[model samples]
Target: MFHYNATNLPLQGAPGSLGRPAKGAAKKPPPRRRRVTLYGLTFSLPLLAWQLLFFLAPLAFLVALSFWTVRNFQMRPDFDLVNWATVYSNPVFWQTYLRTLVLAVGAAALTSLLAFPCAYAIAFKLSEGARRWATFLMVIPFFTSYLVRVYSWQIFLSDHGIINALLGRVGLGPVPMLNNTFGTMVGYLTLAFPLVVLLQLFSLVFVDRRLIEAAHNMGARRLRTILEVVVPSARVGLVIAALFCFILTFGDFVSPLYLGGGNPPTLSIMITDTTKAGQQWPRAAVIALTMIATLLAAAFGAVGYAYKGRAR
Candidate 1:
């Protein structure tokens, strides 16, 4: 073998050498990265435009409306704190706001309680075909118009309606149902239960069945397995379900308007009443902004909880 100094060895492609590329070398083309980025931007444009037009633009206008003053039942362009002051000063508004919070929290809690078991059964216990059927049944109620469902509930809860009629036949006087907190909550649950159950079912279906089986084999009881293993695993879904219920119920005017009376008015109803009575757009906007702020805070909290649970 001919011995050669490493420093004196001619490099590849040196003078009089064959210009072959070094083996196993790779080069990335810059345009490939730009193409990928361009593809992502192209796909995202529709969604971005939709949000800007329908959500952000409307929200911006609403915020602007909230700051403007309303004078003589006509909206004035002058910015003032008067609308906010009126909202804060009114005791009735405060009472209504608090009541709305109570109703939303209460309904969400109850719906969660009712939703989890149904979702668990559908997700884990049922066969695939059975799960599909059960899911369909859960959504069937929603196929009916929302307003029609609310009106149906109104009829069902009325003094002479189906529930009261059945109760009266059992020798009990017609319990107060329509235009009360109880009735309002029932209506909220009726509308929200389907959504809650669906969300929770979607969550539960993705949970590893093997983990649940392992927990069971370790002598965990049914309730313990669910509480410790299943619930923790599905916490994100549970949070989403509860958040949806709370947000929907919090902003619902129709249920409280038709089923609940003035004694326990919700913020949505209060906003409507204020708008109808005075055409006070700015004040209404303040109330709207308050509700928006509250829901946003709730959304942030739910997202934070979900992400924290996921992180763990």
Candidate 2:
């Protein structure tokens, strides 16, 4: 009959304490996060140094050389605006610049358009084994020297070449394909087509299949679905492929010189012409710098468009 209730019993610990920690007790600190460390810098420094040495140093030297004077076919370290003024004043330079720009833009557009269907088939229509084989075949083109490939094309594209011989057998006769814009485009396609197809296939394969299926479920036609969903999903890859084509075509000297017969010389040809004409290396530097600037502007613009509205 003398049992005590636990609730009514007095606590034997600190005053006003109800089995809780003291207010003055030390609290645990939050874990520290390292944004950058010596470990990361150790790996990144080598790459940074490489770029500094090979890219930045050379670029800086070229810029300085462009402003220097050329006396007696010798480049002298003297600040002069003669090279810039002369290059900018030349009508031929401007004309060649315009032509190079047009050809590069044309190559980018043409290559992207041509590569799309082949990439789509590889990505969606082929089985895994077939896809692998197709990709492997595409890669085979890269194994051969690009110069050798261009040379070999002469065998097929030149007048009375295999193509024209076949055409002759069909009573169609020969067609002039070489030493013209057509031949230049063919060479550009040879350089860029397979690469574009591969890029597009890689992007297309990673697209969400469910989104495509949902488009079909909503009564959208296959073409419409691809236009609305697939193309948008793969826009980055497509744009980048086109950009690469532009860069390659813009700076190319071989195709335009050999295939197109250098009828309308590009910027690369202009640089060579400048250098060979009294060894005007400073003026050549100016042309090279202009090309670099154009490529940078195009690349920045394309990348901005491709990644618009994308998350960081």
Which regions of candidate 1 are displaced past 4 Å? 1-30, 35-47
Candidate 1: RMSD to truth: 9.9
Please list the Cα RMSD from the true structure of every candidate, rounded to 1 decimal place.
9.9, 12.2
Evaluated against the true structure, the overall lDDT of model 2 is 0.87
The TM-scores, one per candidate, come to 0.83, 0.84
In angstroms, the error of model 2 at 59 is: 1.4
Worst 10 residues of 1 by lDDT: 26-35
Candidate 2, TM-score vs. the true structure?
Answer: 0.84
The local distance difference test score of each candidate is 0.83, 0.87
Q: Model 1 misses residue 194 by how many Å?
A: 0.6
Give Cα distance to truth, residue 107, candidate 2, Å: 0.6
lDDT tens digits by residue: candidate 1, 1-312:
122234665552333334554345533222321243444567778898999999999989888887888666678787788888888999988988888998899999999998898999999889999999998998887666777788888678898998889999999968889888877887888789999999999999989889889999999999999999999888899999999999989999888878776556789987888788876878888999999999999999988988793554
